[model samples]
Target: MGNIPDHDSYIAAAPEAFRPVLNHLRDLLRGALPDAEEMVAYNMPGFRIRGKVVASYAAFSKQIGLYFLAPAISDHAGEIAETGLTASKTGVTFPPHKPVPDHLVKRLANASIKHVDD
Candidate 1:
């Protein structure tokens, strides 16, 4: 409630069923944004680049959620139609049941980096 849970602590504290998923998501974000710093923002595990909030991940009761702080899919609908990432006003969702697609994540990461620099 006061601050988002820390990612490492979250992974360490999560139930066994979610460990692998959390690990994969953590690795994906780290691999994508190798230089981003970890911070807790918006009550989620947030990543930043040059002080810009780029991405976030949350471990929820139903699924693990990832957010790319870039233009929403609604704004880039045509170009990224087949990516299968869903978006709302705030951010996108990558459901935990399926493996997070590498290409989609990379695209989102690029968008984040671009947006942060722009």
Candidate 2:
């Protein structure tokens, strides 16, 4: 598919049931990375800092997925498990039926930022 132009447009195009989930996750990322630039990367809505991908989210049929562009994102397996979300090799998956926990999202965002800048 072609690019969605911007983050808002990308979120707007998601399934109705998924819009809020996407927005919520986006908000969490924004709250954690205020200085990060919003951008469309890999055809998904994402945040970038100093030219490096920081965080990103994608709306899917069964769940909303959040990716912290850090190799060690899975290092927080304990916290991620508490969110009741599935963890993949790349990121965490938040099922649509359950709201993603704000604290977990923030933690992932902070860790990602530190990994990028530290």
Instruction: Please tell me which predicted candidate would have the highest TM-score against the true structure.
Output: 2
Question: For residue 52, what is the lDDT in candidate 1?
Answer: 85
In model 1, how large is the Cα lDDT of residue 26? 77
Clashes, model 2: 0
Whole-model Cα lDDT per candidate? 0.70, 0.82
The residue-by-residue lDDT of candidate 1 on 11-89, one tens digit each, is 7776667778778777888888899998887667778999988887777676667677657334455545466656665
- Would you give me the overall lDDT of model 1? 0.70
lDDT of 2 by residue, 7-109 (tens): 8998888888988888888888898999999999778989999998888888887788888865547668877776667888668877777866888788888
- My TM-score estimates for the predictions, one after another, are 0.77, 0.90
Model 1 stretches astray by more than 4 angstroms = 1-5, 72-85
